[model samples]
Target: MEKRMIHLDETDLAILELLQEDARITNVALANQLKMAPSAMLERVRKLEEKGVVKGYSAAIDPLAVNRELLVFIFIKTKDSFANDKSARALAAIPQVMEVHHIAGDDCYLVKARLSGPMELMEMKRSKFSKIPNIISMRTTIVLETVKESSHISIEK
Candidate 1:
């Protein structure tokens, strides 16, 4: 993917900040808060979406309610080169796997997975992950408690 610097004005920043706080905020309400016309606010939001500054919005689900109470971060060491996407693609294909990061040092990939319990995690490892090619080893870490977890990024005021 190509990386480029996106120039954002104060209005754009403000809009992003507001959206970050409440993704479900209405266009009229947002415009009212920002003291701008609703149409103008809509246009700005559209521009933000087009520029890829604003991604799609969705409701945040409670993992416990969904029976995905266990949050596990697995550090994966693969037989393939770090640049290879084979293992990453395979991991990404799994529905339980949330995020996959190609990292530095001994570990090739770090995967975030949600499971019902320890038994389900072990079963997933034995059935799903173990079937994937080029996996050398894996180290799993379970989260005891979530101190902070948010997808929002800081926007200039």
Candidate 2:
């Protein structure tokens, strides 16, 4: 199948900005804000999804409220030969992992993980992660505080 690029106009961009702020906003409310009919607004949103502009929606959970005790950024350098789908899949299966980014330069992958405490993080390193074959090295940095985190994407239209 061939993929087509759909260009978004200013109105579409505005709609996206509003939705990013609150994904659960009702279609009628969004239409009122954008000054368009609800049916038209819904069609635009459906088109955005079809074109893969709006991938999906998710709730932003407060980590503190859920007793999340730690946030760690792990840099992993794997053996060049071992960097493949097998290794990536192995890392993804670990429950503590929140995000995995394939990086350039010295490190092969960077992983963001949330855990209960230092002890749990250490146990994960020794038991689950270390068992993965051909892992060259793993470096971890615990987050002291989050300065800024925004899901909003800047759109120029």
Candidate 3:
């Protein structure tokens, strides 16, 4: 399906930037920041959601605090170019798999996973990954240090 392009005004863009920074910001507070009435601000926000500009809100959790310190990027090679997507969907069902992308180049998929430590990684490979069909091979790259990570997108009018 093709996506319908939605136009956003300056106010809508402002709301998006502010909301991205702090999703918990109250509507009255948001209105004060943009110097608009609360009702007007709320209506604009509602429209933004209806138009699909504002997808949804979520909290950012600290991976370390949750004991998910080990970060690894797994480059997966699959057979048949994943025409059926059975293997792709099965890989996604695992709890540790954070992000999966159908990538170009030598590999078919690039998967981001979080684990407690090396032991869990080994267990995932043996028990979880070994069950998925059509997975030809996987090359794991452990992250030594993360300079920066963010989910915020620059909203433009």
Candidate 4:
């Protein structure tokens, strides 16, 4: 099926801005803040969802608060043959993995992981990562500090 792109007006943009600030805001409260009727506000929200503007809501959790120690970015170079089901299965079994992106350019994939310390990272590399078939190489970088982290989409409309 052909995909259709939805254009957002100023009102839609405003609604998105408010929602990004607080996803849990009730429709009534949101309507009051936006100076629109609750029903109208609800309709706009439903339209946004239908158009895929508002993908989904999620609770932002503090990694440090939960004893998540190390944040590592791993650049992976996989053999061409590994792109099939085996590579995906190998990646899925790793519990420390937070996110994986299929990247362009030299690196085949970029993997984000949270672990306890260097020891855990090393163990993961030695055991699970090494065992993955047709992995050419893996480069890892530790994040000392995060300057900024945000999920808010900057709407240019």
Question: Whose lDDT is greatest here?
Answer: 1
For all predictions, the C-alpha RMSD in Å is: 1.1, 2.4, 1.6, 2.7
Q: What is the full ranking by TM-score, best candidate first?
A: 1, 3, 2, 4
Candidate order, lDDT descending:
1, 3, 2, 4
Q: Residue pairs in steric clash, candidate 3?
A: none
Q: What's the alpha carbon RMSD for model 3?
A: 1.6
Spell out the clash pairs found in candidate 1: none
Superior by TM-score: candidate 2 or candidate 3 = 3
| Candidate 1 vs 3: which has more TM-score | 1
Cα deviation of 139, candidate 3, in Å: 0.7
- Cα lDDT over the full model 4: 0.86
The residue-level lDDT of candidate 3 at 59 comes to: 91
- Cα-based lDDT at residue 67, candidate 2: 68
Backbone clash tally for model 1? 0
> Can you give the lDDT of residue 152 in candidate 4?
88
lDDT per residue (tens digit) for residues 87-106 in model 3: 77888999999988888899
Tell me how far the alpha carbon of residue 98 in candidate 4 is from the true structure, in angstroms, after superposition: 2.0
Go through the candidates in order and give each one's C-alpha lDDT: 0.93, 0.87, 0.91, 0.86
Q: Which stretches of candidate 1 lie over 4 Å from their true place?
A: none
The TM-score values for the models, in the order shown, are 0.95, 0.90, 0.92, 0.84
- Per-residue alpha-carbon lDDT of candidate 1 for residues 1-157, written as tens digits (9 for 90 to 100): 5898999999899999989889999999999999999999999999999989898898889998999999999999999875679989999999999999999989999999999999999999999999997999999999999999989896656
